[model samples]
Target: MQDALAAHPVWVIVVDYILGAIMWTLIGRAAMNIFLPEDSNFFFMRFFVRATDPVLRLFRPITPGFLIDFLVPIYVAWFFFMIRFYLMPWLLGYSVMGMLSFPLESEIAALLYQAFNR
Candidate 1:
């Protein structure tokens, strides 16, 4: 219990974890873009394409576009938000933005939770 409590507020750990996720996401988008244009260097493209596909697949049907469409980075940001909010706050303590966003995301997450929870 003491160890866990002590570990909660480390900013360096949190930032690194989130940044790692973002890099993976960027690599994935780059791979997809490479494939879309033409079939080239399948060996290298396969790794990045695979790494990011799970998340990208979620929004794949929607065509990419300007700001709203450029969700690659946004998804990374939101994923980190969820981890920091719902998962980490218990350790680090109350996060103002997390507390505020909970109700809003709950409305969103719960719908999916209900649909898939069973």
Candidate 2:
């Protein structure tokens, strides 16, 4: 797995993690929107809303009006999910790798490499 990552430029791994984090944040923001009151003044809620709204807004024009407000976040999450899960792997030439496993393996490998060398 490390070899696969090493075969690519460093930016691919960086982008993969960034995209994954954004996907989860979008999902989290969507959930907050669903369960919490719109007026909820929680700091994280505001942060999520501020961070995600622009990205969600990009899709707003194509989204059907009748789909309900909550779906917008979910739709945005799915869009990023597709990019992270499908497009990125192919573009990075790791299409055969498992999405979740590769990252875990990379982390574990790094730890092992560090422990043994140091």
Candidate 3:
């Protein structure tokens, strides 16, 4: 696992971090929508809406019209998840298709493990 982390360039890690953040944020937005109205004016809700708007808009053309408005974030987040899980590994020249590609989460888990074990 350490060797896999060391093999990637810094930029690959940065890209993975960014994509993972977006993916999680979009999912968070979807989850939050369950408890609050879209126009609730709450800080975190507003942040989620503002941060994810552009991404949703970019995907609007491909997004299905039949989907409820609040469910859109999950739909769009799925694309980011796919890119991170599948495309990143291919870009990094991984010959195997099922290898883990989430460096950001992996690094976080490793850090947490070390912190808890000590």
| Each candidate structure's count of clashing pairs | 0, 0, 0
Lowest-lDDT window of 10 residues in candidate 3? Answer: 95-104
Q: Give RMSD to native, each candidate.
A: 14.6, 4.9, 2.3
lDDT of 2: 0.73
**Candidate 2: tens digits of C-alpha lDDT, residues 19-97:** 7677778888878887785467998888888888788778889777898787777877788777766777788676656
Q: Candidate 1: TM-score?
A: 0.35
Model 2 poorest 10 in a row by lDDT: 96-105
- Residue-pair clashes, model 3: 0
TM-score: model 2 vs. ground truth: 0.72
Per-residue lDDT over 1-118 for candidate 1, one digit per residue giving the tens place of the 0 to 100 score? 2332254445634453554465545545554664453244665555555665565666555535554433564555455565656565555455544342433333456678889989
Identify the candidate with maximal TM-score. Answer: 3
Error of 2 at 25 (Å): 1.0
Off by over 4 Å in 1: 1-6, 9-23, 27-39, 59-77, 85-87, 90-92, 96-118
lDDT of 2 at 48: 86
Q: Name the candidate, 1 or 3, with the larger lDDT value.
A: 3
Once superposed on the true structure, which residue ranges of model 3 sit more than 4 Å away at CA? 1-5, 96-101
